[model samples]
Target: MPASPREEDVLTARELYRFYRAGEEETLALRGVSLRVRRGETVAVVGPSGSGKSTLLGCLAGLDEPSGGEVRVDGVRISHRPETERARLRALHIGVLLQTRNLLPHLSVRDNVRLPQRAAGRKPVTSARELLAQVGLGERMDALPRQLSGGELARAGLAVSLANSPAVLLADEPTGELDGETERMVLAMLRDRAAQGCAVLIVTHSAEVVRSADRVIALEDGRTTAATAPAGGAVPAEVSDATG
Candidate 1:
């Protein structure tokens, strides 16, 4: 049986709504969307383009405020707070990996991973070197973002995202640009993090990502349509064990 929400849920959103207005036009990007990601689970959010996937991720991560509703991380309210407060909460509990990549071109891989630790003003649960090593980039820690190849850059970005040992990891189209093999590798690493007790949520259209997730949530026309197990179920044991 699944764990109780009160015991294992690390990320929660209820009745989320997002609206944008310009002059006489009003657009609703998200309409009363809600979901939960439990500790040590991998959830994939899948939907067609313009179906509010990005908006949902933004609100969940506290990067964008919902027009009406609430978001909580580790049982603390994150939405409706002032930007500074929201940022503080995000730094402490949320790690976001965007499709465009989350690294700074000018910073070395190690420094990029350390940035969130500095912002949180707390000791990292894992050191920068350890994170890079876990992602198979130990020798590339001193390399700049621009110097790394595609797969290396992706893993480096992931290391940065995991630096603070966030309770929830929100990834937007995390493997959109990777080749099939690399995508599998990255998904394996993400699952490894989940195994270590971090709730991981990925927004993507990738079939591989959906297959790797423990559960799949589908969105359509700005609201949740259904929640189901992946067509192929969870990642295979072989894939899950390739995190190194």
Candidate 2:
């Protein structure tokens, strides 16, 4: 069954704008992008490269301060919080999977998965073994990053992202490094998280990812000008039997 939406949204953004200043010019990455993700909802943000998909994720995750507008996560306005507070809140409540697998080269997969818990000043509640198993990395828990295949490393990163059982999961190009089958597996895991009541948002260019979402929001030239729900009008299935 689909999880119920929380009375309060898990994530809300209003008129968000981000701009980078060069010596004599400014580049607008996001312009007036407003979005909301209710608890138990899965939203996919899609656009071509440089369309500000990643930038939107960063702003939503509180990794970057927006040049203008408001962003609230878990009902708190994190966009204006102090850096330390933002970092602390993120550690406690947000799970982020970036395009790059930013694992520590010296740490084994198990250790890397537990790092987030340690950073949050909490003992790891979710067993690394269990998480690795969920990601199909149970046998590779002791493997170092260099010894793992690209897909294995990606799964490890995902397991680490779920370390806190966060209220929100933010993934950017999560399946970019995986093969077709692995990508399906990863998306299924994400769908399971949303089914379990986490607000899941993925920023990707993949058609498969978009189709898996409850809603698809498209960005063009730094603005969200298109938003659509699936034609069937039923909630997305947990897993699609079809393949890319």
Among the numbered candidates, top lDDT falls to 1
Residue pairs with colliding backbones in model 2 are none
Each prediction's TM-score against the native? 0.92, 0.89
Top of the candidates by TM-score? 1
Residue 110 local lDDT, model 2: 92
Residues 131-157, model 1: lDDT tens digits: 999999999999998899999988998
How many times do residue backbones clash in model 2?
A: 0
Writing each residue's lDDT as its tens digit, candidate 2 over 1-244 gives 1133246589888889999999989999999998889899999887766889889999998899999987877877889788888888888889999768558899999998888888788866678889999888999999999998877878888898998889999998888767887888889989999999999999876668877888888888899867778545542332232331
In order, the Cα lDDT scores of the candidates are 0.86, 0.83
